[model samples]
Target: MNLLKIENIQYSYGKNTPFEKEVLKNISLEVNANDFIGVIGHTGSGKSTLIKICNGLLKPDKGQIFYKGENIWKKGFDLKHLRFKVGVSFQYPEHQLFCETVKKDIAYGLVNKGVPEEEQESKIRQVLKIVGLQESYLEKSPFKLSGGEMRKVALAGTMVLEPEVLILDEPTAGLDPKTTKQVYESLKEYQAKTSSSIIVVSHSMEDISEYATRLIALDDGNILLRGTPAQVFSNTERLNDMSLDVPITTSILSMLAQKNPSVNTNIYRYNDTKAEIIRLLKDVKSIE
Candidate 1:
């Protein structure tokens, strides 16, 4: 089922002013339940604007946003309820963390929703572990943790609510390789466990290639492409025209194919590319 649908959404900044400029034009898409959607684009492509509209943080000048088939912008719609269902973690989520302790920070949302104290505590602990944080760290101030830890805490804050749709913008922007991998793994596990829709906006094609089941590429405030990773990454020239690159593994395969035309260059994921390389090597060995 489509958990969310955006229809002909148009949005502009500084509307009716000298600085007025449209950031999104005729954006339309449907987000299915349990979808892991990766949104990619160069700077100023309206990627962030599009997500904000989805989460009800920004209203589109023209179009309708439907949550579970109900128009979110309808006069009597409960926007607050929609926000809970479609949780968003913006870029630099750590900057938004404000509470006495990590526990409190993560529980703020649940508390607002009037979740029982016992339930809030249970969820806080559960989400902390999901984000790879130790139970001991829950008492520490959010400011006292490392950059990666802070980011994880911010992520845990959203996960505690168990939102049906989680939207993250640059969730792994400034972490070490180890932390980045852990974050991706945690998000994957979370999606699998909850069967929730996940939307991630990232610049790293590698992340998209590995984790996203679906990919959306935007340019000039328009969706240039939308498909599975294999389908979208296969259009290398088009992505390049929009100032984007395919995954490193795909690039490697492309180069290998140019050097030895017999090798398949159509693969996107690392594992698939690795298997293809192995198969080609085995075939050459058998011929020898």
Candidate 2:
């Protein structure tokens, strides 16, 4: 089932001023359970605006959003419940932390939602373990932790809510390679175990290739394309024209396929392209 749905969403910023801008124009999309969707686009493509609307942080000027098949704007709908159902981890989420200790920070959200004190403590322990943060850190100041540790603590804060749909905005931005790999892999593993739907908003082509099941491409506030990473990154010309870079991994395979058209390079993903190259070489050797 679709965990989140957007229909003909239209939104404008600074609406009555001379500088008014239309950010999202009739955009429509859906996120199903267990889907890791990577969203990318040019600078002004409205990527951030779209997500804010998706999570109900900002109401749309027009159109409707449904969560789990129920209209969110319907009479007396549970806004809080819906938010808990779809948790959003903002960019620089760590800075939002204000608690004296890591345990308090991670448990902040769960506690505010009125979960029993005992239940909240147990849930915090479970999520802290899930994110691989030690219980020892629970008593330490969040500001004193390493950058990666801080990111994990922030993520754990959100995860403790146990939302079915998780949205992360630029999760790996500004991290060292090793840190990025570890955090991303942790997220991937968590999804594998929980089958939670995740939407990642990032402009990094390589990250998209590594994490996204499907990639959504946007330009000038409109969706240019939506498909698997292999499919979206396969169109070299189109991506270039849109001023977006194809993943280096995809570019390598694309070059190989073009050098010998026998292996159609339209296959954009890394593993599939590798298999295709091996298959083509085997056939060529056999003929020789």
Candidate 3:
């Protein structure tokens, strides 16, 4: 079943002002329960604006947003409930951290939800582990942590609420390779444990190719492509036209296919590409 639906959504900034501009135009999409969706686009393609609308942070100038078949903007609708159900962690989430202690920062959502003080501690600890942070760091000021740790603390704050649909915008924006992998793995583990729908907005084609079950590519405020990673990545030409790159391994495979028609160019993951190369080498040796 579709957990969320956006139909014909059009959003504009500064509506009637001289600086007015439309950021999203007639966008429509469905997010199914437990689906891992990746949103990709060049900067200013409205990725952030679209998700803010999804969580009811911004009302669209036109069209409807439905959460479980009910329009979120319906008169007298309780949007606060929807906000809790669909948690959004914005870009540079650490910038949102504002508690004296990491534990308090992580428990902020729980407190807002009116969860008991005793339960808040348990939930905070659980989400802290889910975000791959040590319990020892909980008492430190969020500002005292490294960039990566601060990001995890910010993430833990959102996950502690146990939202049914978690939306993260550039969750690993500036981290090193190892830290990026850790963050992605933690997200995957949380999804697996909770069966929650996850929407990640990222520019890393490799990360999306490896983790996202579905992909959506935006251009000029419109959806240019939507499909599985394999389906979307296969259209390398179109993505390039949108000023987006495919996974590096996919690019390598494409180059290999140019020199050797026998090599499979459909590979995306490093492991899959490595296996195909080994098989091809074995075939060449057998012929020799």
Candidate 4:
């Protein structure tokens, strides 16, 4: 199920001036249901700008964006309704928090969409749990929560909309390792439960490679590459050529596997790599 499609999209900034710059150029991609899309690139790659266009926050100067096979920018399209369906959690979601309490902030979008008050509380609680925020924090001021908690609360607000597609930009930035792991695992579990498609914009392959079904690489306003994490990571030289680095583990294993085939590390994921190593060691010992 292709949930969203972007075709020949182009965006320009600072129009009507000699300083005009075009960020995206002839970009086309298909985003499917239940797909975890990881977008990676160096800074200024137009990744954020592209996603903004997807959610209707920005209209591209050229090309079309489709939702469920229909041109989303067509006349009579309800962009507000589309936004609710494809929830976008920006790079620093907490910065958008303005309500008095975490509960109100999370419920803000739902309320704006006219969901009943009774359903609002239920939805808020459900999404808060989905983002791993305790019930106690619901009443607290979002301004006072820790960085990680604030990020989760921000995500909770977005999930309350029950969107079919979620576009999260650098959701795990500036968090402690434990909280980052928790946020990642929480979203993974939520995706498993709901089977919702998620598109994450991030520079760190290490953050999402283990789970993202596809990775899209962008650089200097162009889509440099797109494929499964393993497939994309295989082109280490290309990644470097674009000023991006593969996951540290992938680079380490890739170098070692070439020099020492006995390493037998054929996996790009952590658990799979560990298990493969263990199985190989047991086989080696058995032969001895």
Measured with C-alpha atoms, the lDDT of residue 180 in candidate 1 is 94
lDDT of 1 by residue, 70-169 (tens): 9998899999988899999999999999998998899899999889997788888888888999999989999999999999999998988899999999
Sliding window of 10 residues with minimal summed lDDT for model 2 = 261-270
lDDT string, candidate 2, 66-143, tens digits: 998888888998888888888999998888989999999998988878888889888888877777878898999999
Candidate 2 lDDT score at position 102: 96
Whole-model lDDT, candidate 4? 0.86
User: Per-model C-alpha lDDT, please?
Assistant: 0.92, 0.85, 0.92, 0.86
lDDT of 1 at 8: 94
Local accuracy of candidate 3 as per-residue lDDT tens digits, 136-242? 99899999889999999998889888988999999999999999999999999999989999999999999988899999999989999999999999999999999
Counted clashes in each candidate structure: 0, 0, 0, 0
Q: Return the TM-score for each candidate structure.
A: 0.97, 0.91, 0.98, 0.95
Clashing pairs in 3: none
On a 0 to 100 scale, what is the lDDT of residue 141 in model 2?
98
The lDDT, on a scale of 0 to 1, for candidate 1 is: 0.92
Give the range of the ten consecutive residues with the poorest summed lDDT in model 1. 262-271
Residue 223 in model 3: shift from native, Å? 0.3
Model 3 vs truth, CA RMSD: 1.0
Residues 100-212 of candidate 4 have per-residue lDDT tens digits of 99999998998899999988988888888878888999899999998989899999888889888988999888988788888878778778877889998876678878768
